[model samples]
Each structure stands twice: as structure tokens, then as C-alpha cells.
Target chain A: MSNRGPADTPPSEYEDEGRERLSYVVGLVLALLLTTGAFAVVWLDLLSGGAALAALGLLALVQAVVHLRYFLHIDLARSHRDDLLLILFTVLILLIMVSGTIWILYDQHIRMMA
Target chain B: MTLRGIVGLLAAAVPGTASAGSFLEPAGPIASAQFSHFGVISALMLIVIVPMFVALPIVLYRYRRGGKGTYRPDWEFNWGLEVVIWGIPVALALALGMALWKHTLEYDPYRALGPEPLVVEVVALDWKFLFLYPEQGVATINLLALPEDRPVTLRLTSGTVMQSFIIPRLAGQIYAMAGMQTQLNLLASETGDFIGRNTQYNGLGFATQSFTTRVMSPDAFAGWAEATKAQPAALDAAGFAKLLSPSVVSEPVLYGRFTPGLFGQVMARFAPAMVQGHGQAGMAAPPAPHQGHHHMPEAGR
Candidate 1:
């Protein structure tokens, strides 16, 4: 019903869809890279031991953040901000619970052993 | 609603040790108390965990596309409810934590929890428990004998990687770490054959890592030890090496007339620093002509 020809239509919608698809592929590649990198760090720690284990654990945390941000598309969108915040809070709680258990148990063991 | 249905669901969800197994019976009072503590803690946790799981689906379904309520975008926070929910669990956890701490101290392995305790030096080899009795001067592999009502102290260390020493009726699992020793105190009120095993997965032989425990009268234990000890002259270093060789299925062997300080020597081998003041300082070294100067026992022959 438009008076203008089909050539006059703006190409912004096609460009937007293409960008969404490209972001998705980038997200997939990032997820694979982070996962494999995390595994490599853990494997190296197993072979080397000691400080490598600490380093591996730290890398794992970073890789988990990378996965959540890029692969999961957890970003600055207002609608999804609450979901991202909840996830961050959950991760914090889990870290606190796990680290607390290990610290308390290790302390108790040291005292008993001494 | 139905207990059987709930049990079925639980069994489906958590397999392995959570379900019934032959290895869970207590060999002593300490183990029994520890098991009870675990049970209480698990029960308490289920009260919160089960409700959370049950509410998950309800919340998800209610929030789905075509639900009844007028969906309000402005609903932000529920601070009071959050505080109440989290506060109760925190209080409960603190109370449980204190109870466990007190009990753990009371049941400390180094302290004598009972009278006339039997001491068993447990060496976790490739896949077995080597029990050495210093007082009796006898050593046995994969077999343990103890007199009922006596407190049993286990001095545990691993030959290789870390392993967890566990005998359900005797006490909770304690670590058998390389270059380190862990002690567990156990007192058996009843006389029976209980099983002890490694709870940690170390390597290929881990699945078969187990030992037989017999709680008999003092006279019976002495008789059993004497019978096993009097078998033959398998007491030299070569004989000891043969015994120590890794095996998947080794029949129980006992040495009645063991060298007086074999236990100390074994301890020194794994943990050299701990046996400093225990008459091991001035004692002559190994019979082998190795790194240090010591009296050498004739090899095997």
C-alpha cells in the first residue's frame, strides 16, 4: 500500500537480526573457550599440585563469570538485571558456604592434630 | 503424603551410601555416636531442603505465561520475609554447629575415650588394612581382632595417596594421609564381626579396599593372635617385603613373633619426625645396607 518503491525501505531490521545471530555465535565460541580453559587449569593443577591448585580455582571463578556474561547474555538490559543480580547473589552464597565449610574443617583438624 | 512414596523418591534421587549398604554397621560406640550425629544433621537439613524443592515447581508454574493473578511489574522486595526465612536457618545451623563441635572434642581420637583401649596401627596399603599391635608384638593384614568393651585407638596412615579410614560402628571416617597420621578412638559394646574399609577413592584398587574386624573376648583374641603368629618364621625383612608387595586379593597373614620395633620402623618410614621421643631416637636403624648407618638384618633367607 506504500506509494514509495520497495527499494526505499530502510535495511535496519535485517541488520539488527544479523547482529543478533552474530552475537549468538560469538557467545558459543566464548563459552567453549572458557570451559576448556577452566578444565586445562584444573588438569595442570592435578599434575603440579600446591599453588597451581589455588591458581586453578581462581581461574575457574573467572571462567564461570565469562560464561555467565557472554554465553548466557547476562548484561546491562534493565528487564534482565534482576535475574543477573539474583544469580550473582546465589554464586556469592554458594562460595561463602563452601569456603566456610572448608576453613572450619581445616581449622578443627589442625587444632586436633596439634 | 505417603512415606513409601517419599522413600522411593529419595532412593531414586540419592544412590550409593545414602541408601542401605552392608558396610554401615558400627564396630564400636564412637562410630555409633558419630552415625547418630550424622542422622540428626541430615534430618534437620531435610526439613528446609525438602520444602524448598517442593516450592520450586509451584513458584515456576505460578509465574508462567497465563496464570490467574494480575502481574504487577512494580513488586520489588520482601525484606521482612527474607530475613525471617534466612534467620531461622542460620540460628538452627549455629546450634547444630555448636553441638557437633562439643561432641567432636569429647570424642577426640588422641584422648582415651574408654578404659584399656587396644591400639591398632593401621597402614593403608594398595588396598588393605595392615593392623600392627605393638603390645602383642603381632602384625596381621586385612584382619583385625579386638577385645569387646576395650577402647580401640587406630593410628592411621596411607602408604600412597590419601584414604579415609572408616568402620561405621567403630566411628566416623578419619583420613589416612601420606606422611601424616590420623587417630580414631572406638569402643565396641557388643561382640561381633564388623567390617572396616576405605571411604575415599584413591585408585584402581580402591573398590576392594576392606578389612574384616572381629570383636571377641580377651582370651579368644589372644588365642587367635597366637594361632596366626605361630604359623611360620615369616618375620625377616625379605618376608616383610613379600608381605608388603601390592596385591589385589591377599589372604590374611599374621606374624606372631614380629621384630620388637617393626611398628616404630613402619611409622618412621611414613612419618619420621613423630617417633622422635618414643624410644626410636637412639634405636639402631634398618637391617638393610641403605642410606643410613644401622644394623642390617639378613635379607629373607
Candidate 2:
């Protein structure tokens, strides 16, 4: 009943698989770079507390996108629309829960600090 | 009366029999703001909930066999109706989420609402609350005293397992984790006592872990502090050590002196090596933890 083609298709499918492997390798290297950048900032103590936090958060977000795009194969391609929408919805729910918990908890920390 | 009417009446009567846990009956600006948020959420929810409840009977009766409702067997879908159905909830949720975000910032406990708030260092033990008024050089077990209309800041952490500190009438709850610090800022709009408790479960003595909050005038608070300072049970290292015995404190006990950095020492107990020479010197600075930077392994994925 689904529109998905069979897993064992022709030479075209094999070409797609080869390209997928290349993207994975590229994503892994990029992820490493981002992670190292975040560590370098922290280990070197180049930035203050809030700046370091912001830098790390931004790097982490970019790293997440790298993983989703290359590793998970989520993209703006028409064929990926349904799966991307599902993943985006999942991300939306996670953003709500995680951000809400942090806001509610950390706000208290700010108010109560001596 | 219908079942709904009966339920409403029963809910109305609940206030008479209870000790009070109504966020609706807030006592301060924080609680009042929270209550407004609650109002918006409930009203929005009712826009969804009330329709579902009402439409159930209407749909069942109308669409039942041989009913007068217009039949549209050939229709697979209605684009306009579908758009409205999906769009309304999405729009509502987006708007509500933004409001929550705004309020979260506006009511940030760390934002310093007014003048320097009275700092009350709260240590959540297994079965009781140990409060230290560092400025007043006084401590109390299971009793909190705050001056009315003045912002009071609570810097809280757990000596035992993770717990949450909440005074339902005054402000929202925040977790008190072992080896980590959390905070809550609150104030009493009136002179009265409210119930505060550890909403987190931590082994056997969890049920008994609650405290009495007495909000008094400035003069009354000063009087209470002076009278508490004269109490015999001084909060030296030994007194604080005795508090960790894993038993419920039946009544509030006052201490003349609380050891400096006592709250930090309690947190450091869970991470002994993390707090090196400070604990031994009997004067550890309060827990202001810097989060560690760690990387996720690619292989794990």
C-alpha cells in the first residue's frame, strides 16, 4: 500500500547508496570540527561564562543539524518531505519539554543567587 | 442535577475540607502571574475540551441510524473543514508556547525583582528541611520565616537525593538536586503561615518532609530572629551532622549560629572530591557549580 520502492532496485539505487556513504563521512568530519571548536574555546578559557555557553550551544545546534542532514538523511528533498516533517514534529515536542524545564528551573537559580 | 452539576458542587465543597493547595488562590505577585497563565491555558483547553465533550452526544444522536442529519456518503473530505481543524490547534499552541516563553523570562527568579532579597540557604535532607539564614547567623529545621511584601530568595540544594521545593500559594516548584544548586524567589503578600514541602520522593521519610512558612511584618521578623538567636540548639557542625540522621524532625528547632558555607558543605558531601580543601577548613564557599564541557562520541550514534 506504500509508495516506497523495493530495497533491492537497480544500478541507480546503488549510486544513491554510494553518495549516501560519502555524505556520512563528510558529516562525521564536520561534527568533529564543531566539537573540537567548542572544546578549544572552553579549554583555552577564551570566553567568559555566558559567552562560552552561547558558543557551545550554537556549535551543538550546528552539530545536530549536521547529524540530521548527513547521518539521518533528513533534507528538503521532495522524497524526504514526510520523514522530515515527522522528525521536525518530534524536535518541536523536544524543544517544548527541554526548553520549558530549563527556563522554569534556571530562572529560579537567577532569582535566588546571593 | 446532572452529573456535571454534582461534580461542580463537590468541587466547590472541597475548599471547606482541605488544608489548601489552590494555585488559584495565590498569595503574591509571582503566584498571581502564574495564575493568569493558568487561566489562559485552561480557557484555551476548554475551547478544545468543551467542544469534544458537547459534540460527542450531538454527533452520536444525529448520525445514528435513521436520524435526520444530512447524509453525504459520496464525500471523502472537506478541505476547508480540515484546514480549520488542523490550523486552529497549531495556531493556539504556537501562541501559547510564545506566551510561556515570554512569561518565563519576565518571571525569571534570577532577574532580581526588587532590592536585594533576603537570602535563605535551604538544604533538603532525606526527611526534613534545614534552613540557614546566613545574614542573620541563625538556622531553623522545618520552619521558615519571611517578612511580608519583601522578596525572599531561597538558594536550595539537596544533601541527600534529588528533591523539589514548593510553596504552592506563593511560587512555583524548583528541583533541589544533590551536588547541584537550584533557586526559588518568593514573597508573601500577607501575614500568614503557608505549607512548604519536598515534592520529590527520596526513600522512606519522604512523606514527613514538610515545613511551616510564617510570613510576618519586618518588626515581627526581627523579633523572631532575635528570639531564635537565643535558642540553645546552635547550628554548629555537630548540630548539622545530627540533622542527617534520616529521621523526621517533628517540630521546628531554632539555632543561634549556622556554620558558614554550610549549604555548600552539604552538597559537597555527595561529591567529596569535587570540593577539596574547602570542606576541611569549616568554611566552604556556597555551591556555585560550573557545568562540565563534554563531547558526544560519534561511535555511540
Candidate 3:
């Protein structure tokens, strides 16, 4: 093992400057395609209601992954495990709070109408 | 001579001190239920809170340096201690969550309290409330008079910005937003004067946007409505336009006559699509013919 800490060590892929730039360009194109697809799905009335929602949600998820991998340089590599874990933990906390609130409020709404 | 004694004396001197505006001294069934709900929540919270406070000082003194408490420097996690520390809070949270869900459903503001409700169309304006009695063909600014023992169904909408309508002694607060209708059902149990107000801060005159809620016997209510209808003022389009201006109303203004379907017009102002098929200037929709039970024209949004 190397004496250098994880923070001090350079990522192997980033050592190739051309490949790093190519990854960014690829991520940008994919992000733009996904965004345009989402807009088209809504604007062109390609889908309605739940179907439309699901399609948009799928595109958004893809865009988020692309951004994370390219812009934020977060990935599933061994060196990036801490960053991924931190983000996942944050998402878990937000999901717990937001979903808990919605569940309670929606339950109340149904009961109120009943 | 004591501070507590002086406070007690002063409290006694103020007649009907907390009774008029406090949910703690509830004047209605809904408010009474809310008051008990509050009591229950507080008591449950105190079960956890009180112990923490009581243990804090005791723990500090017992574990202080050179004290009689056991000095276990090498001590690690104990399963029994861990369970106890986590278990109590988890159980308390579950209990509180269940209680909140149960009570929220039981006291829903939209749920009708009783039969044969007295309908009151409420419009929240800048620094004031306009209440229209569709059945009586009369309207009042900054005043809400209801017959005791009869449920009052309030269909609330805001004429300008968003506002919250609250009559603490009667029921809980409900939001009123421009172009959207919200409903609240409440029934005063006894004849008395309670305070009502817009709890949401909108602009400069928000502090003064309060109204007097008078609950009286059915017979007295009828008489008062008749007396009010005999007043000269009318809530015509021009008068309503004037009321739209931001100002604090010091005294309640009673309008004997008001334009029919005025409530719908106010709601339609924000949502023009609702009035699209009417084939008239949105403001000039034909006056609805007076019926025994005058239902406010629906703004089909």
C-alpha cells in the first residue's frame, strides 16, 4: 500500500487529460439529451398523467447520475466510496423526513375528506 | 405584597380575562377538543422532558470528579443500557405519532359539526374580513355573528393576498388564498363575544385586521340580522372596489344589500378561465335570483 492518504492520491483516470475532457463532453451531451427528452415528453403531450410522470422521473434520475459522475466527480470507485456514502446518507435523511411528512399529511387529508 | 399575589390580584381584576380569546377556555366543542388534545400532547412530551431535566443535575453531581459514584474508566457499551436509552424515546415517538394522526382526523376543520349549518361566505381583504350572509342578502365588514348551537359553515377565499382565519375560542386556524376556496365548520356552544382575526401577516395593517365574533340565541340572531338588513349601506361593485384598498377598519360596517354572486366574482378575478364561458365581463355576471337557501355561485375552476 502507498504511504499517501486517500485525499492526497491522484485518481488514475484523471491522469489522462484527453479522456477526462472526453468524459465531460459525453456527460454534457447525455444530460442535454435527457433534459430535451423530458421537455418533449411534457411539451409534445407524448404521455399523460402517471406515464408522463414516470418517464420524466426516469430521465431526471439518469441526468443526476451523469452530473454526479462528470461534474461532481463522484463514482463507485474505491477511492470515491466515502463521497458516495455521504451522499447516500444525506439522501436517506431527506427521504425519511420528506416521506414521513407526506405520509402523515396525506393520511390526514384522506381522513378529513372521509 | 408578594409578586405572585400581585399577579393573582391583577388577573382577578380583569373581567373575562382569558375566556374571550383563549382556546384553553374553549367556548365551542371543536376548541374544547383541541384544548384537550393540547393537554394530552404536553403530558406525553413531559414524560420524556421531565426526566431529562431531573436527571441532568443529579447525573452531574454524582459523576463529578472525586465523587462517590463508581469510576469505570474502561467501561464500554452495555446491551441493556443501550436498549433502555433507545427504547424509551422510540416508544414515546410512536405513541405521539399515533395520537397526532388520531386527533387530526377527529377534529378536521372541513368536517361538518352538526346539521342545518348557517353558511357564511368569508373573504379576506387587505387588513379586514368581509362576511356575506347569502341567505340574508346582507354583508358585514370585520364582523361575524352566528347563532349559538348552530354550525357555521365558512367558505373562505382571499380577495387580495393569502391570509389565515382564526377564532381561537371557537376553532383552529384555516388558510384562505386568492383564487382558492377553503372551508371551515364551527359551532359556538354559548352566547358570548369572541375575538377573531387574520393570523397571517400580509402588509402594514396586518396587526389591526381583527374582528368581533358575536354568538347569540337563534331568535336574537334573527333579530340582529333583520336590524342589520335595515342599514342603508350596500356592497355594490363600487363599494367593494373601495374596500379593496389597504386600510384598517376601526368599526364594523354593515351592508344591508350586496350584489348577488359577489363571492364567485372575487374568486374569478384571479382565475379568468373560470369565467370564460359566462359570455359577460367577468365582473358583470347576472345576479343570481334569491332563493330560500342561497348557494354562492360556484367559480368553476
What's each prediction's TM-score?
Answer: 0.59, 0.67, 0.74
- For candidate 2, the C-alpha RMSD (Å) to the true structure equals 10.4
> A82, model 3: CA deviation in Å?
1.8
DockQ of candidate 2 (2 decimals): 0.06
Candidate 2: Cα lDDT at A32: 94
Candidate 1 backbone overlaps, count: 10
Q: Give the per-residue lDDT of model 2 (tens digit) for B36-144.
A: 7776676677767887899999999998889888998898888998998899899889888998899999997655557889989888887889899988999998999
Clashes of each: 10, 3, 0
Candidate 2 lDDT? 0.76
* Candidate 3 chain B: 10-residue stretch with minimal lDDT: B282-291
* DockQ-based class of model 1: incorrect
Global fold similarity of model 3 (TM-score)? 0.74
- Misplaced by over 4 Å in model 2 are A1-114, B1-18, B271-301
Better of 1 and 3 by lDDT: 3
Per-chain TM-score of chain B, candidate 1?
Answer: 0.75
Candidate 2 residue-pair clash tally: 3
In candidate 3 the C-alpha lDDT for residue B64 amounts to: 94
